[model samples]
Target: MAHRSFLPSARAANVIIALGAFALGWAIYVRYALLEQSSVGLACRTLETLTCETRATVIALFSQSAFGIAALIGAILQLIRPSLIMFTLALMATCAGLVVYNNNLAGLAGGLLLISFARPWRGARG
Candidate 1:
């Protein structure tokens, strides 16, 4: 039988790239436009508007390192059983976490994801 490589196909790579880029861009927008913007921050701290409420919610989640935690969990799962879904989840969460002040666990998750790439192909027979 012909050997099947574990590497992602071009289409899969494109999808991953697109999703990762979107996650990164969204995180940057939230960090700069919503969280760091003085007007937005002030409004969120004081006002009860819908935008401010949304900002507060995002702040609470990132403050608790939810994104990093999720990335780490996805990375660990991917390391244990390498799958495209888990890999994509970890990649997207890692990108978002790194940009949204969850760098510590997200960095660790990134390393774990890298290590997982070295794992033997799941379909390979010994």
Candidate 2:
């Protein structure tokens, strides 16, 4: 009798991918929503500073959006075909997003999925 490793199935992977998509969507939505509601607060506080408020806002927005987009793409690819490349990309994107936006929950979820999916287990072997 061979021992079986606890690995997620394709269905589980799909679920994880869906969750990642949701996270990506929420991140984008929330960031934009906040900006729209309180553009001044999100901008730089000092007017005399070298860095302009508008410039800071644009940079932050771009960084967050780019990270979310990359993660979303990676998640979509993983859903279509589970691969190490896709998993790594997704993990990296999620980490970057967390660093930029301080989104702990999304980062943890995405990281867990990527780590679990990357490993070779009984059910994941396809």
Candidate 3:
């Protein structure tokens, strides 16, 4: 009977998550501690040039709001369904972009990389 044969690899999952968390944390720390804060504004300015000033501002604002919502929702999902991990990851990507736009390459790179590798959805897959 296909009742239960293979249980998820809790050890592996935990290890992945731990490492991912560490990577993410270190990334953020490096950004704030090592890199000059002014880089953030430069990142934002770089985003601004891609489009017209007026529209760019609006898009940036909307993205910021979405980022918050996504993070909140993702957190809530943690209790009910681990699958939200992917949503959280996607949101993290959005946040990273904003960070980079704000001239924070460290945050953008580290934060995004953390979630992508972590894979919260792993356990929730079943």
- TM-score list, all predictions: 0.87, 0.39, 0.32
Runs in model 2 lying further than 4 Å from the true structure: 1-64, 102-126
Model 1 C-alpha RMSD to native: 2.9
Sort order, lDDT high to low: 1, 2, 3
Could you say which candidate leads in lDDT? 1
Candidate 3: clashing pairs of residues: 39-103, 40-102, 40-103, 43-101, 43-103, 44-101
Candidate 2 per-residue C-alpha lDDT over 27-98 given as tens digits, one digit per residue, 9 for 90 to 100: 565456443445544454545344354446645765567665666667656645555556656755775466
Task: Give, for candidate 3, the lowest lDDT window spanning 10 residues.
Answer: 1-10
Alpha-carbon lDDT, every model: 0.87, 0.55, 0.43
Cα deviation in Å at residue 29, candidate 2? Answer: 25
Runs in model 1 deviating more than 4 A are 1-6, 45-50, 123-126
lDDT of 2 at 23: 54
Residue-by-residue lDDT tens digits, candidate 3, 1-126: 123222236765575466546545643543453343565445656565432353345446444654444444443443234443443353454453343233243244345434443433434334
Give the better candidate number (2 or 3) by TM-score. 2
Count of clashing residue pairs in every prediction: 0, 0, 6
Report the lDDT of model 2 for residue 103.
Answer: 53
As a TM-score, model 1 comes out at 0.87
In terms of TM-score, the best-performing candidate is 1
Sorted by TM-score (best first), the order is 1, 2, 3
